[model samples]
Target: MQFIDLKTQYARIEPELKVRIQAVLEHGQFILGPEVQELEARLAEFVGVRHCIGMSSGTDALLAAMMALEIGRGDEVITTPFTFIATAETIALLGARPVFVDIDPVTYNLDPAKIEAAITGRTRAILPVSLYGQCADMDAINAIAARHRLPVIEDAAQSFGASYRGRRSCALSRIGCTSFFPAKPLGAYGDAGACFTDDDALAQALREIRNHGQDRRYHHLRLGLNARLDTLQAAILLAKMEIFPEEVESRARIGARYTELFQARGALGTDVGGAPVLTPYVHPHNLSVYAQYTLQVEDREAVAAKLGEQGIPTAVHYPIPVSEQPVFHGGLLGADYPVSAAVARRVLSLPMHPYLDEATQERIVAAVAKAAGL
Candidate 1:
């Protein structure tokens, strides 16, 4: 069984995908092509934002957003440590410090309560990651940023179609960056990303930054990186968007089934009424796209091994926290983020996708319960 079932998704859109790619080929506008602009416009409209700048990759999108905001040397950006390294890597790349914040144990997102304590005079931005297809608490984060006159960049790589308080993920902050990697909820065929914002001036800066800081032909306005999105990827995304809304609904239906099945076991004593395995928490005010159906199991290794034995694939979203990474852990001790450290040792991800069928999910869930010896 495939972990993400990309093959099924590909088959569903194969005809459209072929036509879109062929169109790009026929036009021969590979870079900054008509498709790119069209895609940016569509993405902006979808996110309820004024502008969307297509980028080379998710990492480039983050880098370009930070560059557009001019976050560099001696500046600090507060973020959670229990996420992919790219969230913090881009900050350090610009010679800025990534101030680590502990995650909300329930949401696995940056805890807003700890954010104000981390902010200081050097703080330039607050980068909150919307992990596992759910939007972070952007309202609180934005209030803090507003008080400090700092920008808020939502790392929305895992959450494209997610919504928070009726607002879309990429439209919830000063600048929201999302990925088009194949596994993301809304993805392209290859590497691609986008930066969304309501500010026109910042959008202009980002457009220039993606094209090597060009304000005009051969005019270098600032130091920048080549981060343009390929026209082919844009075309693929435009096709995918046609079915993206229903796909998100499918994910929610499947996710709800998984939650019900796991909660019915009633073996785990941690949550009083829930099962032993702790399923993901989607706030009442938000909608998650179920990028991954993750569980916090006491014996993660045992559960994963058992799933493998049953021919069910399982993965670990993250086994190490970003704060513990060697490149950035110079002064941070392992105990600093106690929650991140403990959560890292227990998280496991099961096969999740919009096409997942109920019978297959039941089989997978039964395998997990048996694996845990429940």
Candidate 2:
């Protein structure tokens, strides 16, 4: 089974995808074309935000957001270490330090309780990741950011369609960024991303930043990067948006079904529940899109190998915490992330996609049960 099953999704949206792509080809405005504006508008409306600035990639979106906020050398950004490196890499790219914080073992997201303690005079922002399609505790994190008078950027690359307390993922913070890397829950055919915000000034700044800080033709307003999204990607994303809501529902259903199937075998447990496998624990207030239905399994290597033997594909969302990456070695001083460290060693992802049939899902789950020796 394909880990993400993008092929099935492509088939589902083939007609619309072709029409959109053809239109882009006919129009020949490959860069920031009309499709890009249309996509930004649709994304903004979907997220309940006032602005959505299309970008070249999720990494660029994060970089542009930080640039607009003026986070640079000598600054610090507090973030979780249990996520993909892009979350922290963008922070470091701006000549700023990424202050590592332990995650909430249950949700695998930034622990809000530890956020305040990490804030210092140099802390410019709080960057929280909505890992594995569920949102972080934005309300609690926002409260802390309010106290510190800092901006909060939700790295929502994995959670574009998720809901947190009735709000969408990309609408949950001062500046929310998400990827469209063909594998995200709501993705384009190629590299693309967007920055969402309610603040008009920040929105304007983000738009300019993505176009090399140009407010008017050739008039550089500030130092910026060429982070604009391609029109073709925007067209493809627009077509996918037509069925995104339904896909989100399917993802939620499939994720729940996976948990139920695993539990029926008495194989499911919490992060610290001592059972051989731990299922994802989403907060009641949030509706996860389940970008990946991950499990924390004992004897990870053996379980993966067993699954492989049965022709079942499994992946590791992350095997190394961002804080422990060689590039940042001896850098994030005084870091002691026991939770992220532990999760890194144990996490495994199963096949997850809206199109996964019930029969296929059962087979995959059974393989996992046997692999974990449940």
Q: Point to the candidate with the largest lDDT.
A: 2
| Model 1 lDDT at residue 221 | 97
For each candidate, the alpha-carbon lDDT, in order, equals 0.89, 0.92
Residue-level lDDT of model 1, residues 1-374, one tens digit each, is 88998888889889998999999999899998999999999989989999999999999999999999999999888898999999999999999989999988877899899999888889999999999988999999999999999999999999999999999999999999999999999888889999999999999999999999999889999988899999999999998998899998898889878888887875442242333337777888989998988888887888898889889998887999999888886754233898788889999999999999989998998888888765
What TM-score would each prediction reach against the true structure? 0.96, 0.98
lDDT of 2 by residue, 1-374 (tens): 78888888888899999999999999899999999999999999999999999999999999999999999999999998999999999999999999999998788999999998889999999999999999999999999999989999999999999999999999989999999998899888788999999999999999899988999989999988999999999999998999999999999999999998988898765544543338888778899999999999989999999999988988998999988888888776456899899999999999999999999999998888887788
- Model 1 CA deviation exceeding 4 Å by range: 267-277, 332-335
- Candidate 1 Cα lDDT to native: 0.89
What TM-score, to 2 decimals, does candidate 2 have? Answer: 0.98
